[model samples]
Target: MRIKYAIPIVFFVALVIIEKENNIISRVSDKLALKQTPQAPIHTSRSGNALPKRNVSVTSLGKPSSAFTLMKRHLEKYSEHQQAAAAVTNGRKDILLLATTRTGSSFVGEFFNQQGDNMFYLYEPLWHVEKMLTLETGGTNATATAKAYCDVLRQLFLCDFSLLERFIEPLPVDHITASLFRRESSSSLCREVVCSPFVKGVYERYRCRNMRCGPLNLTMASESCLLKEHRAIKVVRVRQLETLRPLAEDPRLDVKFIQLVRDPRAVLSSRMVAFPGKYKTWSNWFMNSDVLIDDNEVKKLKSNCDNIRMSVELGLRQPVWLHDRYMLVRYEDVARLPMKKASEIYKFTGIPFTPQVNDWILKSTQASKETRGIYSTQKNSAEQVEKWRFSLPFKAVQLVQKVCGSTLKLFGYKFVTSEEMLRDKSISLIEDFL
Candidate 1:
């Protein structure tokens, strides 16, 4: 009886050792995953008394599973897959602007308040949804995720929102907006205001900012700022042409447009440092990012510019685009004499410039002059804006010149030195426009 029991006990001990070894093997395999963080390392150190440094910041904010990370690794791969057929468009009737990025869209939008009583300035309509998420969670992960989503939304909605009318409504009847766009009223506040095709995409992207859909409001909405109103005529600046195109195309709107452009070299040099790590960086939210173009990225961005150019150029030539009225502004010019440009913009849009509007433009322009685009004569306010000549590197400067030289030349920018001449074929591109 003693021999039989002893034999069984010896077998059980052997099994326990094997099971422990299997667990150790499993832990080893789980660590060092490419897409995921490894488990907490054992706390042993060479001195035995000290533990290793562990970066728990990631874990504290909810470290994704290694499997989730692996799945994310392949996310970019599926980006090329064909999209399902998009839905048809629902039309909107509002004044709109057709233009590109790095343009004075914000400033131009400010000009809209001067257009008249019905005018409403939907400032950074696309940015609200972004602010929504951050305002919701009030933490690092939420902020980071919100920003990334905002970038994705902006990039994905590259085309004018009007083009995808089926999937979206330009002036969606949300709680804050419902008052302006009641179904029973043919003369609703939404129609009264110059809603752009750009509004829908931007609003959709920023919708996250307002879960109560709180007025899709601004941080400064209650600052008691007066309207830069006109009795008649409505105009608004739109930065995204794809969004502007369809909205301006709608027959209900007596749309008037303005296309604003800036120097490409100035554009790139000005933005490189503002957002160091491309769209992923939080710093990019305010600074210009166009200056970091390489050969391929230049190709993509230039294609975007070209599409904008054609759209605006077509609108200028035809009465059908924006009800046949349009104007073009150079951001460089506006930076120098914002008051002058704003005055001229009011005239071109057929609105009487009110004292309030004039004062607003002057004050806003003056206050923001230092930090506005460095294309004008104002001295650099930051190291990032100043190093345009050096920061872009010679090759990147040439790439910008090669891709967007004509657009700059059209705005009367000249190459100042021999270095610029040898590489910039676009030096001659502007003479005809001049």
Candidate 2:
């Protein structure tokens, strides 16, 4: 069969497997003993229910898991050689593209991945850690959690996943996918790790739960971690800006931040449309309440808008030490002029706008009219940005606009009146004039 036709079929099959796997996991989680404790009223969508504990095992690899040991040795040897070469030139950079949900961060992260051999892009390694933290602590302990978060980030930059084992055991599929399968700098070390029994065991466990495993035979280059020029992590999990302060000030690493923001109205509108009746999982990310009092779509949108504003304000109020290391980018600007925006972002991170990066931008953003899911890697950037305007109800838009008025002004996104929403065909979320 042709590649185009086969792609959709494979995606459909994978989607089915993932959905089944989620159901199985939920069932298993419920069946497991809930680890009774003081039963303090913790936060969850299910009202008054405590966070259920799971069987979390922190693998104490005596000899190290075969894959882990091999990867570590390879990275160590490679780093020795790389450090010598890099000493003659500029060292590698560590960049973080930080954003809240529905802000086109996944799209932006792909820019680094497009660098192929030169960049090591980690797609939300901290997501699993966040999950573990919330489960264990009910999302308390801000300071300690922040320290641990930064610590894991530090280790990952140094190409170490063993430090992450305590937080996440048996390695989540997404982690394996990013580190091994889809990575650009997959060396012989990477291949050995991917094909090891450890990864296969995790894949088999996922398969038993009806989840699909990533490809086992994907080819990777020899430049695993030893020779990468840049490492960028795209994260949407951290709510407090203070959590990243330590990372920003680390004397050993050159870290830069790109804070991506979107108009709250557009963000909420997109969320409501894209995930109707299914946002309880991430609704309270920066919000106080879980389920909105009025279980309606408009109320959810309003709540989401409030959360966005709060999150943006928190990110903007960073300490003085982080001032020079940070740059803010708007989703609207990036969607409209992908290459230009990408170039500006590259310049901020000290990465050159290579021809390959530009080519990936064009292909990823301007692909043909195929139905893409919300979690799709490729995006029709311009359409995706402007979609909320026509898709959202006029009244809903008015509510989001009202809640986010100050923030909109802060980001230079003009107010969209109900009348304009009703009659204007060429309404833009962002103001053309500064």
Candidate 3:
């Protein structure tokens, strides 16, 4: 398995999982930052459907069962750790809201953060871990390689530099950095980031005892990072379909996963503005040729709208995990009907739902394919979906329509007309399930 293909998407997506870690990439290139800025927000939506809620228990180690637990733990621990408690609850069903760039993830993740008892609305942990794994393994056997990568995480939690250097780009000097590095020093951030969990966790223990570091810094490093509030979920709310072959075997993270998708026309329409005039639009992304590239070529870009769509469709259809456990959600749906979306998530976790979460769902940015005017011809009763038809030029819309016709139809989106179009569009939904 030369992973020659999926590796790029995997490594790239790992960076997406923990966006903050890309502080490394951010430091290096503004171009990279442009694509990532959209992903900086936090959160997810739970579908609000009625169902039998499963049994849940908070662990003896004082673990949180819902998102709120993680939130309270951090806020109580430090005044500065304001928002972004993690989404996982300890000894409880892990709630993972698969978020894509700019699909109102911040509003959704934040909503859950406020609702759950044990959830920590922390920055995207998946992105951080993903990038770390990719850098370490180049997307080869991501599952086996990332398992080894977990030790590095444990080290950072403890702040043990003994082997932490191996995870760093150039490594760092320990005692020298501690003594010479001034407060808020560049070296300090480097040290803090590279340190093992044990080293940092214990050091945080010392800080809690002392009065150094601001309330925010202390809570973020110590309480949020060290406290036994919420346990990490076995979730990989990750993209990058091909590289996931290795990850598919990890029983913890392998259970069920979700992918966020949007119409390529809409994706390119916004992305055109997101990037500067230089190579900005789909034209720039696609080499600006009048001729359009087919699906096979799009998959090579990995991050491209068409590529991600194919990957998501294929991953769902051919999962290493079981069907009963696997799931999928649309980014547009998450933005449109958050409560309904959140309710679906609650079902996946097999947890109970509360009115409080339901009410929270009513509140959202209300930005989706519907409101944003991106549409599917399915008789789903369109509210405002169809952004591409309205926003993009006739040529751009036609280009996306021609190239992505098959993908759109596979997901149940209807083409304007023509038997060939519909046949090309239809996906193996039954094959995907049966």
Model 3 regions lying over 4 Å from their true place: 1-91, 95-104, 126-239, 245-255, 277-311, 318-320, 354-356, 366-385, 416-434
Report RMSD for candidate 1: 21.0
Ranking by lDDT: 2, 1, 3
* Model 3 backbone overlap count: 72
lDDT of each residue in 1-434, candidate 3, tens digit only = 66987899899898786674444333222221222333221211123333222111112112235788777645544632221222222333333344455443444444444444443333343444445446654453433333433432333323222222332222223211222112221112223322323333323211222224421221123233333233222223344454444333322232234455555555566555554463243454355566554545344333455555756676667654535544566545655566677788657655566676665555333334454332211112222234334445555555556767765665555444332332332321112121
lDDT (0 to 1) per candidate? 0.41, 0.60, 0.40
The lDDT leader among the candidates is: 2
Candidate 2 vs 3: which has more lDDT? 2
- Candidate 1 lDDT over 1-434, as tens digits, reads 99989999999999997786544433322221211233222233224453333222122123356987767645632532222111112221123444444454545555664444434443333333333333433422322432232232222122111111111233222112322211111111223122222333233322321122322211112111112221121222222344444334322233456666666675655455444466333223224455332455657658655655565556556555545466767665666667787788767766556776676665665444455453332222232222345444455555556676565455566543455653454443222241
Q: Give lDDT tens digits, candidate 2, residues 23-106.
A: 543432321213222321122222334333222211211223688767875776576566546533676788888787788888
Cα lDDT of model 2 overall?
0.60
**Stretch of 10 with least lDDT, candidate 3:** 53-62
Q: For candidate 3, give the lDDT of residue 256.
A: 38
